[model samples]
Target: MEKQVNAKPGTKQKKRIKMNMLIDNFQLATLTLPTIILLGIFAYWPMFGIILAFKDFKVPKGIIGSPWVDPIYKNFQFFFESQDAWRVTRNTLGLNLLFIVISTVAGVIFALIMFEVKKAKYVKIYQTASIIPSFLSWVVVGYMVYSLLAPQGGLLNKIIIGLGGEGIQWYTQPQYWPLILLISNVWHGVGIGSIIYYAALMGVDTELFEAAQMDGANKLRRVFHVSLPQLVPIITIMTLLAIGGIFRADFGLFYNVTRNQGALYSTTDVIDTYVYRALMNQGNIGMSSAVGLFQSLVCFVVLLTSNFIVTKVEPENALF
Candidate 1:
C-alpha cells in the first residue's frame, strides 16, 4: 500500500487572502476614522445632556452631579398653560406648511422655465442669479427685507408713494407680515429649492419629451403630462420630509425679519423663537431641553407616519 499523506497545499493562498481582507479593513478604518471620531465627540457623546431634561439641571452642579427632579412634566405643563404655546405652535406649523407649498410650486415652475431656455449662456446666467440668494445669511436676508419694507423709507413704500398711493405701515400690520414673511422666505429659499428640482429636471431623459413632441403634443401638454409626472416622486419625498419638521420654524427668519418686535409676535412667533426666549429670560436648561425633546419626538413620529402613508400611496416615493 502507498503511504498516505494529508497535506493542505492551499494554506499559503488562504493566508494571503486573509491578509488582504485585513489590509482592506484597515484602509477603510483609516479613511473613515476622523468622521467617526468627530461624530462620536459632537453628536452621540453630547447626547448624555438629554438627562438635563429630567434633572433640575444646574450648570453650577454639572449635568451628571445635578439633582434629578422627581417629575419633569411640570415644565411641559407650564409651557402648555401659556397662550404663547398654542400661538407659536400654530404659527410654526402654519407658516412652514405655507412655505413648503408656495416654494415647491414656484420652484418647479422656475425650474421648468429654466429648462426651456434655448440660449445656454443665458441659461447659465439665470441659474447663477437664481441661486445667489441662497448663499446669503438669514441676518443679511432680514436686513434686505427691512430695506425693502421699512415703513418710513422702504423700497416698496417709496415706490408706492412715488406712484401717488398711500404708503402702508409695512412692519406694524400683522395682516401684511404673514404675506411679507411668506414672500421673503420664498425669495430667500426658493433658489436652493429650485436648484435641486432643476438638477433633477436636468437628469430627465429628453427622449421622453422628444417622443411626446413627435406625437404632436404641445409644450404645455408635454410639461403637464411628462415632466411633472416624472418629478412627482422626488416632490413627494421632499414633502414628506418637510411635513416631519412642521413643528419647527426658521428661527432667524421669524426672529430677525420681524425685528423681534413684540406686536409682531402674533404673526411671526414660533416654537424655536419661544424656546430661545425662554432660555434667555429664565436660563432654564431643563425646560428648554424638554421643549427640544418634545419637538424631536413629534418630528420622529410624523416622519414615520408620513413615510408610511407615502409608501401606501406610492411605494417608489416613500423615504423608508
Candidate 2:
C-alpha cells in the first residue's frame, strides 16, 4: 500500500491499466494458448526440415549431419531436367487456375441462391446437405467415382448401354478426366466454399439493401450493385490466397480420385503428385525437399505479385 501510494502518478496509472487489461483478457488468452502451442509444435517447428532441400539426407546422417549437395542446387536441377517437369508444372497451374475460377463462380452463385432462402429450417437443411460432401474423405470419394465409372457393372456404363451407346472406358481416357475432375472438385468443395460467402452476406448491412430496394432496384440489380460490392474484399482475399497455392495440388484428390493411373498423367498429374511419386519410387529426400521448396518459393512470389496488384488496384482489399 505504501509502495503504491509512493509510485509516480503516470507509473501507477500505467500499472493499473495493464493489470485491468490482463484481468479482462485473461480468459481469451487461456482459450488461445493451446492453439498457439499446437501451431508452434506442428506448423512452425517443422520449418527446420526445409534444410533437407539442400542436403543429401541419409538415414545414418540425418538432417543436420547430412552433407550438402556439391552444387547446392543439384536437386532442383535434377527436377527441372526431368521430362515430366513441364507436364506437371503446366497441369498444376492450368488445373488450379481452372479450379479457382470455376469454384469461385460456383461458390458465389450458391451463396446467392442460399441467401434467397428465408426459411431458417430450410436454410439449415440445405447447408447440412451441401457441407456433408466436404467432410467426406477423398479416398471415399474416389471409390464412389469408381463405382459410377467402372467399365464393368458400373452404373454409368449400364445407363450408356441401355441408351444403345457403347460403354466407354472412363479411367483410361485422359480427355474426359478434366471435366470429371472439375465436377468432382466442385461437388466436394462448393458447399463449404459458399458458406464463407454466405456468412459475409449475412453480415451485409440491411439498410443498404433496403435503400437499394427503395431506389427502384430489383433483386438482380441489388445483388450486382450491393451484394457483389460487399463481397469484393473477401473475394479478392480468397483469390489471392488461392493464387499462392496454385503451384500445389490437393494430393489426395489427384492421387486417390484418379487412382494414379499413368494414362491420366497427361491431364491429371501435378507437382505434388509428381514429387510424391518420385519420393516413393526413389526415396530421394533431397529431390523431394527441393521440389517442395521450389513450390513454396513460387507460391510466395505469386502471392507477393498478386498482393502487389491488389494493393495497387484496391488498397482496402489487399491482404498486407
Candidate 3:
C-alpha cells in the first residue's frame, strides 16, 4: 500500500482533483450569486444617489445634470442654520440615549430573571408575550396608545374622571411626551432586546457556574460572577451597534405615535421626521439628501469612536 501511494498520480487523478475544486467553487459562487446581485442593485446602486446631496437638485435637470452647489456646504449650511436643527438634534439624541439605557438594563434583567425559571414552558410563554409587541407595526401600536391617551374617551382619562381628577391631554403637552416616548419605546423594544441577552446567556459555560458553586457561591453570586462577566462581550457588541443609529430616530414611532401633532414637535421631532417634513413641505430633495448624508456621517463617526473606546477598555469585547 505504501509503494502504491508513493507512485506518481496519473492524468486521471490530476483531472479529478481539478474537477472537484471547480465544482466546489461553482457551488459557492452559485449560492452567493443572488446576494451579490441584491447588494449590487440595492445597496451599491443607491449609494450613487448620495451625489444628489451636493447638487442643487431640480427634477428637470436630473441628478447628473443638476448644477453643483455654489459652495458644497450650502445644503449642509441650510440644515445646520435652520431653527429646527437644535430641537430635532436634541430630541433625537436624548430619546435614543434614554432608550438605549432603559432597553439594555431592562433586557439584561429580564434575561437573568428568565434564566432562573426552571420550567421551560413558563419561560416560553413569558418570552412570547414579551416579544409579541415587537412584531406589531407602529401604526397598530399608535392606535393602541391613542385609545389609552385620547383626551375625551381614553382609558386614562376615564379613570381620572372616575377619581374626581381632570383628564390629561397627553398628546398636546410637550412636557409629558418625553416620558410617553420613553415608555412607548421601552415597551416596544425591550422584548427583542431581552431576547438578545437571553441568547447570550444561553451560551454561558455551565462549567463556570459549577466552579462558582464549588466556591460556595450562591445563585445570585454565580449569576453576578459567572453569567454577567460572560455577557459583557455581547452587551458591548449590542451597544456599539446601537450607537451607529444614535442620530436616527424611529420615524414610525415618532411620527405615527405623535399623530404628527404640531404641538408635539418640540419633543417628538427628530432628524428623520424633520427630513420627512422638509421633503413634503418644501420638496427639496437636495436638502433631504444632505440631512441623510449628515446622519450617515455622524453615525459612522460615532460608531468608530465607540468601537475605539471599547477596544481600549476591553479589547476582547470590541467589535472589529
Provide the overall lDDT of each model, using Cα atoms, as 2-decimal numbers.
0.86, 0.94, 0.91
**Worst-scoring 10-residue span by lDDT in model 3:** 1-10
**Could you give candidate 2's per-residue lDDT for residues 73-115 as a string of tens digits?**
9999999999999999999999999999999999999999999
Model 3: residues with Cα > 4 Å off, grouped in runs: 1-29
Better TM-score candidate (1, 3) = 3
RMSD of each: 4.7, 3.9, 4.8
How would the candidate models be sorted by TM-score, starting from the highest? Answer: 2, 3, 1
Model 1 lDDT tens row, 1-320: 87668655488888999888988799887989899999999989987777777778777788888887776586676678887888988998889889889988988999899988889899899878878988888889889989998889999899999999999886677877888889888888777787777878889998999999999999999999898998998889888888888888888889888888877888888999999999999897788888888888888898899899888888988988
For candidate 2, the TM-score is: 0.92
Better of 1 and 2 by lDDT: 2
Stretches of candidate 1 off by over 4 Å are 1-35
Ten consecutive residues with minimal summed lDDT in candidate 2?
1-10
Clashes of each: 0, 0, 0
Ranked by lDDT from best down, the candidates are: 2, 3, 1
lDDT of 2 at 146: 96
